[model samples]
Target: MFRNRQEAGRRLAAALASFRKERPVILALPRGGVPVASEVADSLGAPLDLVLVRKIGVPGQPEFAMGAVAEGAPLVTLRNEPVVHALGIADSDFEAVRDRELIEIERRRRAYLGDRPRVDVAGRVAILVDDGIATGMTMRAAGRATALQRPSRVVVAAPVASSEIAADLRREFDKVVCLEECDDLFAIGVHYADFSQVGDEDVRRILSHHATVAG
Candidate 1:
């Protein structure tokens, strides 16, 4: 078990030291991953950026992700065709959910990053960090979005993840760096002693700190 995201991030960063030579960029899945990624960025002295991908949840079941939207000049979206077909989800319904998520993504981008341009991952190693992986849907979507940017290598880094999902991530990503693997990851907070809620203000502050440090 980890004491908190900070400690987890530091340990994860140590494991990722080999990638420092690659001059990698740290990409965080915001709201929860910001703090963790911030530590990694500090350790590597790399540019910190947000992935800005929101899950397109199923209608009336907001927790169930049918797809996800990632912000970019041209937005990157990936849908689970099997899930949509199995659930008989209408295209209109899916689009509506995606649009709503896009709005949220824009809000977060403004709130946390402001006018700072997104770090280009093209031909660079891109490491995607999150607090932990539960269902792996969001992270998988994030990987797909990062792939569209043509990164030389795409790596998913986290403190803990389900053993099964960790294996799946290995196949999808160029590399997967997780500190701990558990059979049951229903609640990631269980692995941390202090997994407090990471508010919008916290994200804003972390991003600002990284920007200042970078400058």
Candidate 2:
């Protein structure tokens, strides 16, 4: 098991060392992703940014994601069509949840980033970082939203992910960097010794530190 988010971030940074010259922007999916992306930005001397994405949970089973919404001018939403159809989820109901997630996304963006201008990913590589992937719905939304920004390439990086989910992510991102992919993946915490819940304050602190360093 990995020691903690910091250790995971350092290892992930090493795996992505080749991209230092490319100067890829590190877009973290907060609040867990902030610490991981902070290390990457520091190691690569790249700008740190947020790519907020929220999962659309099934009505009764909140852990089972039916879709997700990603931040953008025109928000990006990815639906797990088969699951929705199987559950007989109405479009109206789905739209309602998506709209709620959009509000949360905006709230997080402001909380974590304040009024900082978003980093332009146009014609540059955009690396999306998260602590880990479970169902992969959130990252799928993030990738689609990032793609709309016209980045030259989109790379998804995480410390660990479900082997099956990683394969699905490969189709969405230009590259997927996952250190460990296990078939028996249960919870992301299972792979880390200190998988504490990351809070909004922690995210803000990390972003502040990055800004100070960049300045």
Candidate 3:
């Protein structure tokens, strides 16, 4: 298990050493991904930015992600078809959750990033980093959003992910770089010793720090 998110990011950065030559732009899925992506951006001397994806969870069961919505030029969304069908979630209900998440995505974008310009990924590799992958919904949405910007290649990096999810992500991203593979990732927190909630302040702090370092 990772001692903490920072340690996990350091390990993940080491694994991603080869990407340094490509001059990748790191996009993190905040607020949990900020710390992890910071190490990578620092290691590779790359520009860091946020993807701003919010999970659309099931009604009443908020921990269970039904899908995710990501902020983009025209916005991007992904739904868990099996979960929606199995749970018999109606279109109206799904729309309600999606709309609510879109608002939060905007709020986070304003809060953490403010008027800062987005890093251009058009001709460079874009590395999307998250603390870990559980349902893969958020990461997929983030990938889709990144794709819209016409990156030369899209890469997803995480500290740990289920073996099945890692393999499945290959179809969505050009490269998948996960430090640890597990047969069953019961929860992303299970792999971290200090998996505390990442607060808004933490997100803002990391972004500010990265901007200073980049400048």
Candidate 4:
């Protein structure tokens, strides 16, 4: 596991050095991905921006992702059929929570981005970074959504991932670069030593610094 996100990002940047000349745009999922993406952007001399996706959590157990909301030009929602079937979650129930989370996502986007233009990925490489991958639902949704924006390719980068999900992810993205995959994995937080909750303020600071650096 990484000592922290910085070390993880540095290592990831090394692996992605070949893309430096491509001027690939680094789009990180907010909160957790910010630190890692900053390091990659710094190394690649590319711009960093947030891909604000909200996981529609199951009721009572908010940790279980029922689906995800992909924040995009038209926006997109992908549902987890198995989770819905197993939980017997009705359309009304799912819609209720999805709408609530979207509100929070919008608030965060406004806070971190304001009127700042987002990174243009059309015909350019789009790399999606996250602290780690668990269910891969959000990352999967994010990758597919990014592809629709006409990015030439989509790459999912993470410090670690569960082996089972890693295989499935390979089928979805053009490329997957996970540092390691553990078979006995339980959760993403367990892999990190400094697994602190990255707050909205942290995201805002990262975005501000990224803008200055890119300029």
By lDDT, rank the candidates, best first. Answer: 3, 2, 1, 4
**With candidate 4 superimposed using the best TM-score fit, by how many Å does residue 38's alpha carbon deviate from the native?**
0.7
Q: Which lDDT tens digits does candidate 2 get at residues 4-60? A: 999999999999999999979999998888899999999999989899999999887
Error of 3 at 166 (Å): 0.8
The predictions' CA RMSDs to the true structure, in order, are 1.7, 1.4, 1.1, 1.3
Which stretches in model 3 have alpha-carbon errors above 4 Å? 213-215
Please give, for residues 1-215, the per-residue lDDT of candidate 1 as tens digits. 99999999999999999988789999999888989999999999898988998988999998887988887657778887888999999999999999999999889878887888778899999999999987787888888888889999999999999999999989889999999999987899999999999999999888888885452
> TM-score for each prediction?
0.92, 0.95, 0.97, 0.96
Poorest 10 consecutive residues by lDDT, candidate 4: 206-215
Model 2 worst lDDT window (10 residues)? 206-215
Higher-ranked by TM-score: 2 or 4 = 4
- Ranked by TM-score from best down, the candidates are 3, 4, 2, 1
Model 3 over residues 47-96: C-alpha lDDT tens digits? Answer: 89989999999999978888899988788888899999999999899999
Which candidate gets the maximum TM-score versus the true structure? 3
Off by over 4 Å in 4: 213-215
TM-score for predicted model 2 compared with the true structure = 0.95
Residue ranges of candidate 2 with Cα displaced over 4 Å: 212-215
Residue 173 shift from truth in candidate 3, angstroms: 1.3
At residue 110, give the lDDT of candidate 2.
77
| Model 1 global lDDT (CA atoms, 0 to 1) | 0.90
